[model samples]
Target: MFSSGHLSFKGRGEKWNSTDDGESIATEISSVTKLEVLELCGNSLGVDASLPIAEAMKKHPELKKALWSDLFTSRLNTEIPLILKTLCNSMIVSGTRLTVLDLSDNAIGPQAIGALEEFLSGPTCFALKELYLNNCGLGSAGINVAECLIKCHEAALRHNTIFDLQVFVAGRNRLENRGAKALAKAFKTLGTLVEVKMYQNGVKQEGISALAEAFEDCPNLKVLDLNDNTFGRRGAMQMARVVGKLTKLQVLNFGDCLCRRKGSESIVMNLAMNCSAIQELRLNGNEIDVETAQKIVQMCKSLPKITILDLQQNCYGRNWSILVSHFQKPFVDFGAESDDDGSRDGDTSEEESDKSDED
Candidate 1:
């Protein structure tokens, strides 16, 4: 941690959980400024410790990234928003260089989201690019989180500032259909996203349909992970239709997403027809049979760019090899050249084959 571009005090044990420990560090490094990154997670440091650190951070004129996640347990209900505002104001006063903010695993609920409303609504623009709010107790009822992003988008656009956000991670937050709809609305307003992770959010057909419509706005999207969600046939079909619009998508993970034959066909057929750049596709445990597996193999073969295709834990039985063999095509070359000369450079082993295989 000495003289490095990043600093971490996470999981420092009970000894450094006290306010005195924080004050001592702050005092010792009060003159040091301009940290590129700082992480103080899992310290259980209460408000008293946070205050000193926030005060010390005021000297960092170019603090680009910071994380104080899981710093409190019960105090998150009241302190989450306060600490956010404090850090925001402190950065603004010093110099607004923030890009990523992680507040995950904090047990944050509606109140904390509500608390962010004022900050998002403020005239000061924040150049945030990545936001991580995973497992923060924002269930199906918590639409304020979506609203906060909407406000941020609106404010940044009106002010002509950079809201070029890319990655948004809210996985395991239990954001069901309604919450997904709210986020979709926000997505319609903003379009500079690249990756989105919303695993295990309990989103169904209605929610996924809304998201499918919103996918039209994100043309630069490359990675999308919606695994462990129970979107049925209708939802899968809707997603397939819209996902094809993202021609640049390379990685897609929807394993265990409750897809039947029709649903899986719709997805694979659409991707094969429209998205040819996809490299990795994961549809494990989707109840796929031999017919569905054959369709998947045909679709995969249609795309020359396909690299990894996962169909494990499905109902393909012994016939799963039919699908696996498509992606396992042996490397071969038609042109044959033999360097049988003993004068060849670095030919130390006689067991080496003269022929080389190419894709």
Candidate 2:
């Protein structure tokens, strides 16, 4: 039942495949006098169902959040683009200024990027603050997202408004160097991003360097999680060079990034010198040596607001006591130490694992 301008069919496990199902949902949607939030996750929606729902969406210009993740479970890839196009176009026509648009876990491939281009580049998304596309399998087509965002920014400028996108999450998308660099360009243009999470995307040094440069433009950035990426020495150094600029950064997750001892030292030293608001820091499974890990803990002590320091699955040897002595207030997570060779079987964090299972 819809209540308080909010309607949710989340995790209903119903498959709305026919026009009759679409009309039934549309009738309920149109009946909401002031629909502001709609949650349609955990249910399968086909093109037939989407058309009527989109038409119903046009009646609600007050819509703010569209939580529509995991909506296509067994549908054909070809049908997804049309469904997205119809729904997003209706919102655009309704003159809704969406703040949060979560389409995560949908496996919307490169082909569907076109469907979202018009909606994102138009005035409808001028107020979009949070965009979630995790596990969408964007691949090389992520460039289209960047391009659409750039166009959105341009449209905002033309309309004398601001496209202040704050949070962007696109993990597990396999967006390699090409996709990352493209989004970096868009991020540089927006310059209002607060948090950027792109973990497990196979981004290497080249992509990371571009993103680091883009981060220089985002002075208000607070959280940056690039876990499970390949950020060897050069990438870490590049990121270190820009950490001084992001003085407002609070949560930094570089876990499983393979930022070796020297690279880790560089990043930690820079954070100590520049970022003072850092609260949570995760450097697990980075091949950090005992000496460098000690140095990291010693430096982190200077960060007044430091809370969570995760140094798990590294080569921390027998000096656990020395590291634990540094932080008595903040909880330090020092998972099982790695072998002398700094080898671990699985690098997925408990948090990431939980999220994966949930999605």
Candidate 3:
């Protein structure tokens, strides 16, 4: 029975069943009109309780964030689609300005995909910036999610605020290369996307290659997390090419992505040269040797600023001192020295141009 700007009953799991007490509480919650954020995650609020909450949320014209994750179990099969439809429709209504929505860990299968797709494709679109749909039982059928995002990108175009729609997180949905290709298309459409996280989605080289191409267009993209996926040597080469294109990129997480000798080399080669704005770079557990690690660290030393350069779990055992020296050396020292190196002039000028454009 809560109705403030933020409603949170996260861990009260299965305490209120389909009994009268649950109905009473739901009725009270429905009447609350000041709710802007609703968080019912980690609760076993069955269909009985969820319906009333959805109805209440519909009334909030200014609802911005809703987190109803982890509401699915083995027995609750039939109600999942209905719940998804109701919530999405609520956001679609006129005067509603929902932005951040998290429906992760809800076991949402193909049954509820249509409801979401319809809502995004509808005339009345929201200014949704962040969307999280991780571990939703999507399996290989996550292409629909990418389609919905495409529609959202189209909607944002109508408003001329495409860059406002930034973060799109769909991690652990079992989306393979097909899904990645679909999202790559969407990224091309929405060129202003900042952070895109598709970690642990079984995306391999082809999918990552598509994403790498997308990076060439999205110059404003800052953070990209593809951790725990399979981006082998070929994918790494593509990634290297794309990394050179993103000027504003700051954080890149490719940890445990199965990059071997050539792949690792390709990534290090471009990143050390082109990525001047990079702050954090993760390449742990990629089977890189000591020589490659030293090269990467040495190359990264050219950057004017850096916070973290993780190379743990690689083969950089005896030559770990190279990493220490990288941290010890002043980043400004190479910036001045690299100007004298005629070979690096083009890269330096391009980086400067990108930074000037951002200013």
Of the candidates numbered 1 and 2, which has the greater TM-score value? Answer: 2
Highest lDDT among the candidates is held by which one?
2
Stretches of model 1 off by over 4 angstroms after superposition: 2-4, 14-18, 73-85, 92-95, 120-125, 140-142, 317-359
Model 1, TM vs. native: 0.83
lDDT of 1 at 224: 91
lDDT (CA) for every model shown?
0.70, 0.87, 0.70
Q: Sorted by TM-score, highest first, which candidate order results?
A: 2, 1, 3
In angstroms, give how far residue 238 of model 1 lies from its true place: 1.0
RMSD of each: 13.3, 5.8, 9.4
Q: Across residues 71-131, which tens digit of lDDT does each residue of candidate 3 receive?
A: 6654366777766776677666536766787888888767667767877654434477777
Judge candidate 2 at residue 176 and give its lDDT. Answer: 90
Put down candidate 2 lDDT per residue, 203-231, tens digits, no spaces: 88789899999999999999999999887
Please list all clashing residue pairs in model 2, or write none if there are none.
none
lDDT by residue (tens digit), candidate 1, 138-214: 88535786777778777777778857778888889889888999988877778878999998898877788888888
Using lDDT as the yardstick, the better of models 1 and 2 is 2
